[model samples]
Target: MPQRKIAIIGAGPGGLAAAMMLSAKGFQVQIFEKQDYVGGRTSSFTKQGYTFDLGPTFFSMPFILEEIFESSNRRLEDYVTLKKLDPMYTLSFDDLTIKASSDPEKMRQNIEKHFPGYGKNYDRFMNDTRKKMNALLPVLQNKHASLFDYLRLRSLKAIPQLEIGKSLHDVLSKYFDDERLKLSFTFQSKYLGMSPWDCPGAFSILSFMEHEYGVFHPAGGLNQLAKAMAEVVREHGGEIHTGTGVKKFILNGTRDISGLELDNGETIDVDDVVMNADFAQGMSQLVDDEKRRKYKNIKLQKKKYSCSTFMIYAGVNKPVDLDHHTILFSEDYKRNVEEITKSKIMSDDPSVYVQNASITDPSLAPEGKSSLYILAPVPNNFSGIDWHKEKTDFRDLVLDQVEKRAGLTDIRKNMEVEEILTPYEWEFDKHVYKGATFNLAHNLGQMMYFRPHNKLREMNRLWLVGGGTHPGSGLPTIFESAKITADLIARTYGVKEEKA
Candidate 1:
């Protein structure tokens, strides 16, 4: 029989991960990325001699990444050097600042230092949530193609611990009385681009994983993770075609995806096609509405989406005193969150996240200088705010907050160069649907079996992988989505895993 030719759309982390798995299994794999770069949002760029990660500054759960590399019979250390961040990040509230670390004793001390007598609360949270994490971890690792698949024994056993009807805020409130401490745990919901009050309780594990297992960073930048995966794909005989934009999928008789047509006017035939682009964006652009039963544009519009981000990359001529990561909460954080997620309006007092990587790794900036990555959450395109007009004002607001709250009071004056990316650019330039940078919201209705199945139900020989699909967003889960799809395809084709 001829080798199964698999065509993957986009060279994002998901696509690169899938490519590694398939090529290692002896299937012919070809990945088409619209940009000349390999990592999509996870890629990096350099300006004025300072480097910046396009998206995803830090990673949680190194084991998932390790498993992917192991699946290809390779070691992760060979590709990228990993470092565990000890004071993972600093959280700044109005009255106090707390440094979060994975060391239990240190974390307890920090909690007590800030919230006084809250050490017991941290202990209780860890003891209870660790069980939930173990229960849900295996479930996320598997494929949920149909309702029946999700009803299996493992999932059935884990159901109650899923925390069906509670919000993350509600869950954390059960332990901590102080609002700031509660906010410290709940703020991780932003990884899903969600407000804690709205993000599902099951997702509370997001913060637990960070405090328990720890967070990681690659030596050069987080984008190196993607670059390393791309390298593995090539080592295993896969081909990645960058600067290739897919126009649409070629279907036969309305059900089977035969191949893809590139925008450059080229057509390639293949046995299978995997979508690694944004779920809503890819479906609307590649598959015609007549063929889509579940995710037509109108229905997609109705589905809740994660909020977008307004990013600023600043290269400074002077060194700044800051941690590897810092989060400055807005004065009225809840209101700010509501404004972004519910009211669908820009917040004048937006929460800001700053990454001062130069202090940790000198390679990102020139000697005696530093770089800052500033991100402020904002409404996705659904807000209808004209970013083109608000861009300048928004940048000024973010910088002012950074200077005021982040302790970089003189940050603006030392700026040697800067770049800004608004939600509009995410939609128009990056082809993200609605500029929802984090993809679909993880609401109960849009999760698990209800989320887009790894195997596209409406069409054969087409699969989906990435933040837009099941197990729902974040780098670890995104990697799991790739593993799930790769496993499904491998089983279907009777392909055996190669021994290391």
Candidate 2:
């Protein structure tokens, strides 16, 4: 029998993992990435002797990556070194600061020191969430390709734990009396780029995952994980073509993708195409309107997207006296979130996340210098805010807040090299739909079977593996998306894979 050939678009984590798995299973795999680098948003860049991760600083759920490497008969540690952070991050409110620790007892102690009476609630929250995670794990690990799959026993059993109508804020309010403490637990909703008050209750598991599994930093940067996956793909005889972009999907009749037309004027016939590109953007750009029944341009515009981000990657000549991660909440965080999600506007006092990675890994910056990654969530392109005009003032405003709140007092004076990325760049340069960095929102209305399936419903022999598809966004879920898609393809060819 002839070997089946698979072509993957975008060399992001999902695409790379899919390539690794399929190639290991004796399939001919090729990945085409538009960017010159392998990792899409997860890729790293070097400027003026300073290295910075383009996106995703937080590395949790290492086991998921380990599983992917193991599938190819390799070990992750051989390719990447991971260091677990002690105080995972420092969370700052107006009058309080909490050093979030992964150690349950230490975290409880810190909570007691800050909130006093709420310390015991930490145990209660962890205990209950463990059950929720157990119930939801099976559902997430499997596929929800049809209504029948949605009604399966495992899915039905996990529904109650889903917290059907409650928001993440509502779930945390049950445990902590102080609103700020609740916000500490719920701020993780922003990982999905959604407001905690609006993010669904089941997502409270995000915080649980962090506190339970602990956060990590790779030796160089999180971008190393992407490079590692790409390496594994090559070891398994997969072809990865960087600086290559897909022009459009060559369709057969209206139901199948026969091949891909490349930007370089090259054409490759393949048995299947795995789309790891941003779902909305890829559908609009690569597939004709008449070819897609479910994700047509008109329908896609109506779908809810996650918020965009204003990013600053700076290289400073002096050391940064901060932890590996620090989250600075605005004085009026709720209103700030409302501005980003509902009003569709940038906030004057926006919450900011700063990563002083040099404190954890010196390889990112030259000796006696530091690298800083600052991110502030803002409205996506749908907001119609003119980023070109607002970029300078917003950069100063964010830096001022970081200097005052995050203790980066001399950031401006010590800054040696810098890069600012607004929503405009994310949309135009990165090809993210509407510059929604986290892709589609994970609202209950758009999750599970409602989210795009791993196997593309619009075209046969085509698949999707990314934040845009199930189980959902974030590094771990995106990795799981790759696993699910690869498994589906393997099953179609009678290739058996070990169960996770």
Candidate 3:
């Protein structure tokens, strides 16, 4: 029998992982990434002797990536060294500061020291979320292609723990009396680019995953993980073509894709095509409007998208006296969130997250200097807030917060090199739809079977893998998306995927 050839579009973690698995399973795999590099948003860049990760500085759930590597008969550690951060990050409120530790007792002690009576509830929260994680594990591990998939025993068992109608803030409120403490636990909703007040309660498991599994940082940076996956694909005889992009999918019939037309005007026939590009952008651009029944441009316009971000990657002349990670909440965080999600505007006092990665890994910056990555969540392109008009002022406001609240004093004066990425760049340069950095929102209505399926229901021999598909966004889940897609394709070819 002739070997099946698979063409994967986009070299993001999901696309790369699928290639790694399928290639290892004896399929001919090729990945085409428009970027001159792999990793997409997860990629890194260097300037003036400073290195910075383009997205996702916080790495969690190593086991998922480990499983991906193991599937290829390789070990993750062989490619990148992992360091578990203690006091994972610093959470800054108006009048309080909490060093979030992964150690249960130490975290409890810190909570008691700050919120007094709320310390014991920490244990209660952890205990309950552990059960929630277990119940949801099978659901996340498998495909949710149709409504019937929800009736499976695993899905049925998970529904009770899903917290159906409650928001993440609502779930955290049950454990902590203080609103600030609750915010500490629920702010992780931002990982999905959703406001905690609107993010589903089941997502409280995000904070739990952090405190339980602990946060990890690879030696070279999180971008190293992407580079590593690309290497594995090569090691397994899979081809990865950076700087090449797909122009459109060539149809075999009304229901199937038989090849891809590249931007260079070349067409490659393939047995299957895996789409790892931004879901909305890919559907709107590469797949003809007539070919898409469910995700047509008109329909996609109505779908909820995650918020965009205002980013500043700076190389400073002096060292920073901060933890590896720091989150500074706005004085009026609720209103700030509203401004982003509801009002569709930028806030004057926006919440900011800063990463002083040079403290954790000196390789990121030259000796005696530091690299700073500052991110402020903002409205996506749908907001109609002119980024070209607001970005300059917004950048100053964010830097001010970093200097005053994060204690990175005189940062502007010490800056040696810098790069700024606004929503405009994300949409135009990065090809992200609406510049929704986290992709589609993880609202209950858009999750599981409602989310784009791993196997494209609308097109035969085509698949979806990325934050845009199940299980959902975030690096961990994105990796799982790759696994699920790869497994499904393997099953179609009668290849049994080894259990991780």
Candidate 4:
């Protein structure tokens, strides 16, 4: 039999996952990335004695990846180092300072301590959410099988009972009535660039994975996972060409894609193509005018895109008492979201997320020092805020907010070096689509099957993957999106799914 020839564009988690899986199944897979290295949104860089994940701070559903390697007769632990986060996160509001834990009992205890009578309610909510996750994760991790197919399975008893109708905001409200607890539980929606009020309740399964399955950080940094994934792609016989951005597809009037067109005007042939990019960019640019028009004319929310952070990766000379993840919010929570979504810029107060990796991963910095990535969400590029002036202003504003929030009066002086990432930087590189970081806001109409299909509507030999697809955003979800797209391709190409 002739070898299957396929091409995967965008070497992020999604693209790499698809390539590796198909290659293992005797497919000739080639991966093309625009940058000098793989790991699109998840890529990182080291500058001035500090390293940053560049994007995606938290890790969950790593088991989804473990299965990926297992199918290829490899072990994830042998290939990469992963550590469970203790006290998963530290979130600070004006009046509340919460230490979120991975242990369910410990979490219940903390809730009880912080909000009286929340323990039992939280326990029940967690139990139910875990059930939902049990049903959902497997579906996302392996493939995009028919929804009707899952309906026949017995374990998915939670399928119809999972309340897909209500928004996550309303679902949580029904269980825990406390304002702060509700705020904390639903904040995960932000990971999808969606507001809880409108994002589907099904996304709350993230609660089960992050809180129950737990969050992880690879040994060197989050980007270490990307490095390992690249290794897996190579080991499985996939070729990755970075700095070779795909400009478009070379399609024949037969309405079949022959291959891809490079930005430099070269064309590479392939039997099949998978795109792990901004779905719109792939359709509008890669596909010709005919097929691109078939995509659901999805409109982005006019509501301002999420704030693009002004990140300064700092190596502080002093060991600041920061956790692996520290989220310090501005005075008012509602105002913080409002300023970004409604007002569309840095408000009088802006929330901050600061990561001091050296606290746990000391290798990130020298002895007696800390390496920090400070992120302050500003308006995305489309918000009409000028970056030329606000860049310095926001950087200083971040330092001031940290000093006030942590009571570290001279935090800036302790900095050994700094590398900043402004919104413009994100737009220039990640195609983060106006710096929305999480891609095409996971709003109500753009979620689940409602999301852009893993298989393009009009194209026969083409498919889609990455943050913009069904499961939507976050590193793990992107990986799952790739797996679903691959499975769909396999089935369409006559590869029968393994039966139990």
What are the clash counts of all predictions, listed in order?
0, 0, 0, 1
What TM-score, computed on C-alpha atoms, does each candidate reach? 0.99, 0.99, 0.99, 0.91
TM-score, candidate number 1: 0.99
Q: Write the per-residue lDDT of candidate 1 for residues 371-476, one digit (tens) a residue.
A: 8899999999999999999999999999999988977888888999899999999999998999999999998898888899899887888899999887888899
For residues 195-278, could you state the per-residue lDDT of candidate 2 as single tens digits?
Answer: 999999999899999999999999999999999999999998999999999999988888888999999999999999999999
Model 4 C-alpha lDDT versus the unseen true structure: 0.75
TM-score of 2: 0.99
Cα-based lDDT at residue 314, candidate 3: 95
Candidates by lDDT, descending order: 2, 3, 1, 4
Worst 10 residues of 1 by lDDT: 143-152
User: How large an RMSD does model 4 have?
Assistant: 2.9
Q: Which segments of model 2 are wrong by more than 4 Å? A: 498-500
Which residue ranges in model 4 land beyond 4 Å of their true spot?
138-165, 288-291, 296-307, 496-500
Q: What is the lDDT of residue 22 in candidate 2?
A: 91
For all candidates in order, the CA lDDT equals: 0.92, 0.94, 0.93, 0.75
lDDT by residue for model 4 (1-500), tens: 22878888888888888877777776788998988988887788876656677777888878888877765556789978888998888888778888888898888888888898878887888888877776765555543324564554642654664576787878889778866777778767767765566667877777767787788888888778778878877887889999999998887764688888898888898888888876655665666565554452343333224446677788788888978888887777667776776567677677788887778888887778888888877677778788877788878888898999977688888887888888788776666667777776666456555566787655667778888787778887887787787777777777754421
Instruction: Name model 1 segments beyond 4 Å from true.
Output: none
Error of 3 at 27 (Å): 0.6
